[model samples]
Target: MDDKELIHQILQSNNGIIEARQASEAGINNKTLQRLHQSGDLERIEHGIYIDPNYIEDIYYITQLRCKQGIFSHETALYFHELTNRTPFQLQLTIPSGYNTRLIKDKERFRFFYIKKDLFEIGKINMVSPFGNPIRIYDKERTICDVLKKKDQLDADLVSSAIKQYIKEPGNDFSKLLTYAELFKIKDIVRQYLEVII
Candidate 1:
């Protein structure tokens, strides 16, 4: 089948987001991408990424692009972990320190930050926002720890609420926090919340 037809199938399978590199695997070239765009078939989401413009929002595409092995993290993570009822106004994205994205047109709503790669490994899946933005939340232990790291922006009450909700869910991972806290030496703050809540 032709590139156009193949691309259609690939995007259809991916729920409308395709890696530009993946398309190249099917022998899609400049001419092919140009044709798709000219025909209004593909919309650029980020560098070397394309999505179906028809969809009001491309959740899978943007989520996959932002987190990767990185975690959704911080307050956003707490909400996703179901530890809070608050809906975040800004979407958070965490990457390994030094990770970068190409210039984006409307990045005002994105809050880009970084943590070590080892820190990112503890990230977990959270809910998607109404906009289809993935709120890739960090594990509870990790969320508390992150809050501690940014205590200036957070407080004991916020941390308390997150932990209280976390206990309500069967998703608590104390070991993950202890291990990370000890490894990073934030035990008293991030790891000690367990003592405060229970």
Candidate 2:
């Protein structure tokens, strides 16, 4: 019905966040947002992002929405999956090179690197609820393959350890590695590594 009412529905629908333009499409005017902020009904997470602070408290949802197809990977993804115990130096998200995205929310250790799209596979695994919704994580197979392909960020020890751990599983989906490898250009270094491992 009105801006505040529409915003209320958006908050409940999108876990407390919505793209700014959506407000307008729903009949919310800029003046309404200004009024809401004045009344402390909303807060800006970024230029075009806003949230009802109470409904959407977690910052990662905003970050995740920004990345879209991006899944936290490498050390960051590994830490989240509990596949490794390493402390991450930053929040790393693998995206296509030339990937344009909103400037990341201010914080420490925010890392964004471009990976070939083919490397994006190691898909979602069932993860425990975040803010009470069942979440899925980037699967281990895809993560390890991307790490191996990148190789720089993942230290020799960590890479080797992760590989060994991943390989040990009967359902590890090792073939997913090969299938995803076909997505890349088959560079000599990556191909050589895959040949040795798979």
Candidate 3:
């Protein structure tokens, strides 16, 4: 296909956004991007990130995309899974222990947690953020296990409230919770919480 056709195909597949690197891989040069920008066909949103003029901005997706290793976790994951009523001021992100995080620009807006590489991907799921854009997050089960494991360090009332709300939600998965608890080495604490609620 020709340059314009190829660029159009790439933009269509990428939810109306594309990076300069992605464009280059597809043989769409920077000059072409500049031309498109000059002609009002595309807009530069973040450094090398560009979007079709019609594309809606999604801050969550942008943040996740910019920091590819960041997996939403802790309180942020709780909110994303709808297990908590309070919105977190800072986003919580977890990355594998050895993953380089220099790509993340705005460190102030996020709180980072580093987990062993072996367990980093456990219970990971793709869910839409509040802004309706795709983001990676730990599932409710993993999130519950995390909060339970760190209960002593977190707000006791909030932790209890999240667990109580999670238990009342339909389709809650105890088996998955148990499995994640075992994996996180917090089976005893999780069991204590479950026994009280179940």
* Cα lDDT computed for each candidate against the true fold: 0.67, 0.66, 0.83
Off by over 4 Å in 2: 67-71, 85-89, 102-107, 116-129, 132-138, 155-157, 182-198
Each model's RMSD to truth, in Å?
A: 3.6, 4.3, 3.1
Lowest summed lDDT across 10 adjacent residues in model 3 is found at 99-108
Q: What would the per-residue lDDT of candidate 1 be over residues 25-54, giving only the tens digit for each residue? A: 888785687677778888876667778887
Which 10 consecutive positions of candidate 1 have the poorest summed lDDT? 101-110
The TM-score of predicted model 3 comes to 0.80
Given candidate 3, what's the lDDT at residue 77? 89
Residue 26 lDDT (model 1)? 81
What is candidate 2's lDDT per residue for 1-198, written digit by digit as tens? 766788899879877776778887887777787777778888877666787878746544566655665556777777765667886777677666666776454446466767656544446565543565334346676676667767875577877777666666567665666665555433454457556766
Q: Report lDDT (Cα) of residue 93, candidate 1.
A: 59
Ranking by lDDT: 3, 1, 2
Regions of candidate 1 where Cα sits further than 4 Å from its true position? 66-70, 103-107, 117-137, 154-158
Clashing pairs in 1: 72-136, 77-137
What's model 1's overall lDDT?
Answer: 0.67
Which one wins on TM-score?
3
Between candidates 1 and 2, name the one with more favorable lDDT.
Answer: 1
